[model samples]
Target: MDTDRLPGCYRHPDRDTGIRCARCERPICPECMISASVGFQCPECVRDGSGTGHAPAANVPRTVAGGVVPADPHLVTKILVGINAAVFLLGLVAPAVVVRLELLGRYVEYFGGPVEGVSTGQYYRLLSSVFLHVEWWHIGGNMLALWVIGGPLEAALGRVRYLAVYVLSGLGGSALVYLLTAPNTPTLGASGAIFGLLGATVVLVRRLRYEMRPVITMVVLMLVLTFVPFGGSLSVSWQAHIGGLVTGLLVGLGMVGPAAGRTRALVQWGTCAAAFLLAAAVVLVRTAELT
Candidate 1:
């Protein structure tokens, strides 16, 4: 062996290293090195000897939607709940924050205050409104639904895809509200995102070949409740619910549907992008009319 010269790492050819993998004797860099009881080993060697009692050909565990299975499957759901809770607390402390963040097309908040809303270029309200809640019952119901529906969805879809479904669903709801609802009406809640999770749940359940009765009943019940007028006051935005549901269904199809191999990720993200673009187009048309 050459004493002065060192070979490049097998994984990272650009780097020079003197250390060899304990199991395979292949030169490795610090990045590829995994500490073992005897000495450093390459990533391949470590993975092969992971002690899973399976052959090297065994597949790595992955979520249903192809995401790497995380240690804490519900971590994203918990974080989302925390964020909603914190935002709710902040809204309680400063009532004005709610007014600012809530979804409004275009309206004067006060007698002489400047107009505020998506029409006035406050586009962030589309997403921000999803987290703003004024009533305790409202936040409580949303948070509970989030925990129940979001946990399983998060576990199946993994964090990034789950979060994407959530945010896109919320935006889809906001866009519909902005387009159809009266400009002066104030709308806010996580219901749209929750509904999206519901839609995704339906798709996931179907994909997994689970029993269909429960999901069907849940969907029908939610739709009926959403559409039924309460005391002749249509305070709830059915438009948002419909929008989120449709978007979630489409994205979920892309997620767990038949697309395969290298194109799977492309299809999944493409569906998300398409949903976002459709929502943006709606916003643009609505903005033109409102302005």
Candidate 2:
């Protein structure tokens, strides 16, 4: 018999294989072959005989970062967008809410309400500021970027990992702003988190073996624009952008780096915790200096 006439794998018809599933007696390629007590079996046979009413551990689908593939990959992105929208709407009605939540290192109320800012133990501002947006154009630009970049990232890194990157990135931005900018200067926007997502996107795209030019170009352009005077009146916070970018790059490396399985998870979360602690340390140091 001509060897070319050999049957192809049932699951992958393009690949010819000599081995057959022990249970189903169907041809299977190496990728589809699972070692059994007697002989190799197909993935379907193994799943059916798993006896646990679920796919075996090996059969469960997982994201690149080892997160279980979720049913709705974009769910977290949608929720985040909703939250930012809600906060924006609330700010529209109660402008004070924006003032209360905006990232201020230190600001004294001239009216004698109270001293307010992160330096005054209002630490929540580091994160709350991320969701607070007052300008229509500001919210519009950020939400658009978030939906476009965050959706694919959430799917690749999984929801928990994605959310961690976002929050930590925002904190990283706030921490840098606190450390570098004047205590009285107030800065607020989601650009920091968005920069973080862009950083992470670079890692994901590289891992998937896609072209790097587009992403690299975008990053360089954004970084350059951070310093360029838009109209010589409004200035962007270069510190926050740089801080978030570095944090995202570090976290992204941990998520998709060489580590595998449990080690990958450990490295991923460890990197996240380290990034958070580092930002917290910066905040503490800045607060100490301010007070």
* RMSD per model, one decimal: 13.9, 7.5
Model 2's TM-score against the true structure: 0.80
Q: lDDT per residue, candidate 1, 201-248, as tens digits?
A: 899778655557888898998899898876774467898899899888
Cα misplacement distance, residue 195 of candidate 2 (Å): 0.4
Best by lDDT: 1
How would you encode candidate 2's per-residue C-alpha lDDT over 186-219 as one tens digit per residue? 7898889989999998997776455578899989
Error of 1 at 260 (Å): 4.0
User: In candidate 1, residue 205 scores what lDDT?
Assistant: 78
Residue pairs in steric clash, candidate 1?
Answer: none
Each prediction's whole-model lDDT (CA): 0.83, 0.82
Candidate 1: RMSD to truth: 13.9
Q: Where does candidate 2 stray beyond 4 Å?
A: 1-58, 110-115
Q: Which ten residues in a row have the lowest lDDT in candidate 1?
A: 30-39
